[model samples]
Target: MQDKYATLAPALDSPANEGFAITPSDSSDLQQVTRALYVGEGGDLAVEMRDGASLTFKDVPQGSILPLRVRKVLQQTTAAYLVGLC
Candidate 1:
């Protein structure tokens, strides 16, 4: 049988793109999102969607990877290390 989901590798220590760092004032613009995101350990983060809606993830533990099963275009983050892949 075919796999339900594809495997994903771990997030890198450095930023993936130029706008990887999500700041307080300016929101980071993300590329085309093909798969879910894997968030690494860091402070609380806020994910902004293209439609101006937002979601906040509080106090995520270090080394934890979250599988956010959303296909919306990501606008930015508050403060968290993340990896995006399938």
Candidate 2:
């Protein structure tokens, strides 16, 4: 397979080439830091940032795509069907 963008360095604004399902957990860290998060079923999305700051985005609408660098999705997250873009 030929990837036209493969030679380009990945920047924060670059398109994500990988994605994984996210399971919110307080004890476990994500296998990799996410470049963004896809909110399939949204409400309150709590997450720990790459810098280790914890935050919760309230009233996130369903099917929203959040461009965030996340380290972990906290157990307190009310959102469901989360996918991590890397």
Candidate 3:
């Protein structure tokens, strides 16, 4: 199939062309940094940003799409079934 936007530069708001399941871990980083995260379940989410800053998002709703550039999903995250969009 031909992609009309193939030549366009990808921005944060651009649709994701690739995705991978995310497992929260304290010692491991994701194979690829995410442009966004798909939350299949709701809860507090702790993550390490691409810039190496750590933070937590509280009370994230289920099925929410968070536009974040994260390198790691920390074990402190309570949310489940995370898919990293890249």
Model 2 lDDT per residue over 32-76, tens place = 999999999979999999999999999899999999999999999
Higher-lDDT candidate of 1 and 3: 3
Residue pairs with backbone atoms closer than 3 Å in model 1 (clashes)? none
Misplaced by over 4 Å in model 1 are 1-28, 50-52, 69-79
lDDT of 1 by residue, 39-74 (tens): 564656566544556677777666655554333423
| Local lDDT at 43 for model 2 | 93
- What are the RMSD figures for all models against the true structure? 8.8, 0.8, 0.9
Two-way TM-score contest, 1 vs 2, winner = 2
Off by over 4 Å in 2: none
Residues 1-86, model 3: lDDT tens digits: 99999999998888998999999999999999999999999999999999999999999999999999999999999999999999
lDDT of 2 at 32: 98
TM-score for each candidate, following the candidate numbering: 0.46, 0.95, 0.94
TM-score of 3: 0.94
Estimate the TM-score for candidate 2: 0.95
lDDT of 2: 0.94
**What is the descending TM-score order?**
2, 3, 1
Error of 1 at 18 (Å): 17
